[model samples]
Target chain A: MANVIPPRSGTAFTLARGQRLTVIDPCGEQVADLVAFRADDIDEVISSGRTIDYASRIFLTTGDPLYSNRSNVLLEIVEDTVGRHDFLLTPCSADTFRIIYGDKEPHRGCFGNLAHALKPYGIPPDRIPVAFNVFMNVEVDGSSGAIAVRPPLSRAGDRIVFEAKLDLIIGLTACSALQSNNHAFKPIHYEISS
Target chain B: MANVIPPRSGTAFTLARGQRLTVIDPCGEQVADLVAFRADDIDEVISSGRTIDYASRIFLTTGDPLYSNRSNVLLEIVEDTVGRHDFLLTPCSADTFRIIYGDKEPHRGCFGNLAHALKPYGIPPDRIPVAFNVFMNVEVDGSSGAIAVRPPLSRAGDRIVFEAKLDLIIGLTACSALQSNNHAFKPIHYEISS
Candidate 1:
């Protein structure tokens, strides 16, 4: 059975090694922020720096391994429908809305949602590193080192699948930022299988 | 007198609000990894995501402000000689050497150095985020989104200066990674002025 993450919310659960977790954009054009920590030691969390340094490319796709801070492989991309994703931006938070969007009433955003969901497993707030933003379209101007966020290109039913390489604690969220979701909020679906 | 950090090491210190910090590359082709946090609260630390989002560019230099996670300005670059720097890469760690370089005996890199230097301030290892790499040169291919490390463009005596907007606890290093420093590590010099 596939689990559902409501719009602008998140959930945390455990994944055994070798299990496959497939994240689906059921309504399309929505972003999902995913983060993983080793079950035995939360300190060894997924690291965007290590993964990008190894891949030598900002746009990661199938066959790329997500690496941990300790340089161990945590998960590998086995299947992907929409090839674009973002590893640069940290999860959006109240500060993002206040600073970037000038929102008067700021939403707690993905960082807050992930922190709340992962709290049960003893993952503290500060340990929340940059998330793997699935289906996000972040364009980088390599020459000027500039960045711009664009609406995701995912159509209805687009999905990406990852195979866990270690026993992991995972936090997954339906991103709350309006700009990332083509101005609409939608639930995310996920299936865990051996 | 300028405070000196020996090659391949780091130091932590406090800077009062409104004071100025000048980080000097006394030797050519050396990288300095710098991180700062609010003296009152470590949770309000320097954020690469926020800085990049607000600056709209990756290459921060004179006139750009370094923002904290809370959307507050922590430091502003008041002077810069070598314009290029990196905020995308986390400080190199033991895992960096072991995994990327395949070194049998790894040196504790900038990450370890910063952790050690900042430990006394009650800042745990997990609190270390991506740092502002001063004087280091990194190239990004705009079309492919690929990254390449180049030797520091800084020559002897090149300096970047920052003025504190908030009372700050700073962790800074003469980067240990050979590639970042053109295959040689050299001491970093800094002076704090009112």
Candidate 2:
């Protein structure tokens, strides 16, 4: 059964090694932020540095491996329809909406959502690292080193799949930021296959 | 008088709002990693995302404001001799040497050194975010999103200066990674001016 993560919300769960996790963008242009931690030891979490350093590229896709802070492989991309995802940016937080969007009343963004969702597993807010932002469009200017967040290219029903290489605790979010979701928040769907 | 941080070491201290910090590469080609946290609240730390978003560029220099996660300015570059500094890479760790350099007896790199130095201040390992890498040369291939580490462009006696926007707890390191410092290790110098 497909699990539905509602708009501006998130969920957390565990996956055994070799399990296939598929994240679906039920609606076009919505973004999902995903994070993983070693099930046995929470300290050994997913690392954007290790992942990008080994992959030699920022935009990861099929066949790419997700690396942990300890330099261990945790997940591998088995399928990807949308090749563009962001690992450089941190998941949007309450500060994001206030600082960038000038929202007087800030929304507890994806970071907040992920923190709450993963708290039961004893993961604290500071334990969160940069997430692999799925279905998010970020344009980086190479020469100037400038970054821009654009609407995702994913169409409705676009999905990406990952095969876990280690027992892991995963956090997934239907991102709450306005600019990240093209100013419209929507739900996300995901499923696990043994 | 400047405080000398010995090779492959780190230190942590506090700075008042409006104070100035000068980090010096006393030996050319050495890299230093720097991080700042709000004195009033440790939860509000220096954010590469907020800094890059506001600066609109990765190679930050004089006049660029270092932003906190809360979207507030924490530091501003008041002076810079070597303009290129990396806000993207995390502080190198014991795992970094083991994973990238294949060192069996890994030296505790900047990350480990900073962790030890800041332990007394109530910051756990997980709270540490990406440090501003000073005097390190990182070549980013924009189109492919590839990154390469190169020797620092800074010469002996080169320096970068920052003015604090808020009272801060600052972490400073003389990076231990062999690659970031051109296969050599050297000391760092810093001084605070009111």
Q: What is the lDDT of residue A105 in candidate 2?
A: 89
Q: For every model in order, what is the number of clashing pairs?
A: 0, 0
By summed lDDT, the worst window of 10 consecutive residues in model 2 chain A runs over A48-57
Worst 10 residues of 1 chain A by lDDT: A49-58
lDDT of 1 by residue, B119-181 (tens): 999998777887998987878876667888899999999999999999999999999999999
Local accuracy of candidate 2 as per-residue lDDT tens digits, B3-45? 9999999999999999999999998999999999998788888
How well does candidate 2 score on lDDT at residue A23?
Answer: 96
Q: Tell me the tens digit of each residue's lDDT in model 2 across A105-189.
A: 8988999999999999999887788788999888887667778889998989999999999999999999998888898999999
Query: What lDDT does candidate 2 reach at residue B161?
Result: 94
TM-score of 1: 0.94
Clashes of 2: 0
Say which docking band candidate 1 falls in. Answer: medium
Badly placed stretches (over 4 Å) of model 1 are none
| Candidate 1 local Cα displacement, residue B162, angstroms | 1.4
**Location of the lowest summed lDDT over 10 successive residues in candidate 2 chain B:** B49-58
